[model samples]
Every structure is written in structure tokens, then in C-alpha cells.
Target: MEKFSFDGPPVGDDADISAECQRQLLSPIQEIVKAAVAAGWSRQDVLLAMVELSWDMYEKRRGDL
Candidate 1:
């Protein structure tokens, strides 16, 4: 399929919640990794999360290319 990119608002111009909230929202994802290590989550679970994160990042910056 063909893809197109949209021009986005300037960074940091978001009216959304503050950066602190963003950090808080994501901190748990890190904790989840450590806890999962102790709890013995399968390697597949950890790797799947990584793949999802990578794809999300690629989409986020697709406009730059």
C-alpha cells in the first residue's frame, strides 16, 4: 500500500498533560520488565513488547522521512 505523511504540530506544543505525567505513565513499563524477569515471564513476552515499541516509534517518525 502507498503511504503519505502529514505535517504535525511543533514538538512540545501539545496541550496534553505535562511531561511528568508522561514519565509516570511509562515508568511502569520499565518496572514490568524487571518484575517479569523475577516472575519468569517468557522471553517471547519481553521480545514482543520490544517489537511493538519499535514499530510504534517508526510510525511516530514516519513523517520525518
Candidate 2:
């Protein structure tokens, strides 16, 4: 079986950008959510994705210690 890996967003050594850059990034996220809803992603799907992402983060942090 193939293993899955996730690379989380940069947390260290990344300088904070300007507010405009943040604003620009928000649009793509909004578009994807709009697309997801259009493609019939249910409330449960969203919730499950959130849970999985949180679990992955927890496991990675635990393993890093």
C-alpha cells in the first residue's frame, strides 16, 4: 500500500506578508469552497475533512517530539 503524506503550510522562516497578499489568497479559498458546494460536498464532508486535518496535525506534532 502506498503511504500518504501532507505538507502543511509554512510555520517557520516565512515572513508575514502584507494585508493585500492575505486578501488575495482568501479569494482562491472562497472559490474552492464555492466549487465544493456546487459539486455537492455535504456538511458532513466538510466536518470530516476538518477532523482529519486536525488529527494529522496532532499526530505529526506528537511524532516530532
Candidate 3:
């Protein structure tokens, strides 16, 4: 992943911007969990898979760390 920094003017108050960022970040995970559940996956299994995937991605992104 590429590093990103906001160099432009502020879009909103910090609290509002942070809240929106949290919502945006979680939206995809919520959808993924919903789909997994709908497809008959247990919540535990889905959560474990999510954790594993997150760690794997983190390792990949932080190569040689």
C-alpha cells in the first residue's frame, strides 16, 4: 500500500472526519461478515478468517519489518 497524507484544507471538523473514516473503514468488513453469515458460515469462523487475513495483509505490507 502507498503512504498517504492530506495536504489540502480540512474537509470537516476532526471528530466528524474521524467518525466518517471509521464508518468507511468498517463498511466493507460489515458487508463481508454479512455475506459470510448468509452463506451459512459461523460467526466464529468468519471472525477467525478475518483476523488471519488481516495479519497476513499486515505482514505483506510491512515486508522485512
Reference-based TM-score of each model: 0.39, 0.38, 0.58
Tell me how far the alpha carbon of residue 14 in candidate 3 is from the true structure, in angstroms, after superposition.
6.9
- Best of the candidates, TM-score: 3
lDDT of each: 0.67, 0.64, 0.74
lDDT of 2 by residue, 1-65 (tens): 33434334445556455444555556655665567778999756765786698699999899789
Which of 1 and 3 is the better model by TM-score? 3
Alpha-carbon lDDT of model 3: 0.74
What stretches of model 3 exceed 4 Å from their correct place? 1-21
Q: In terms of lDDT, which candidate is stronger, 1 or 3? A: 3
- Could you tell me how far off, in angstroms, the CA of residue 15 lies in candidate 1 after the best superposition? 43
lDDT digits (tens) for residues 4-61 of candidate 3: 3433333744546655665665766787788889999998899899899989999898
lDDT of 1 by residue, 1-65 (tens): 33433334335656455455545546555666777878988757986987799799999999999
Q: Show where candidate 2 strays beyond 4 Å.
A: 1-35
Q: What is the lDDT of residue 52 in candidate 3?
A: 98
Best candidate per lDDT, number? 3
Runs with alpha carbons beyond 4 Å of true place in candidate 1: 1-36
Residue 19 local lDDT, model 3: 59
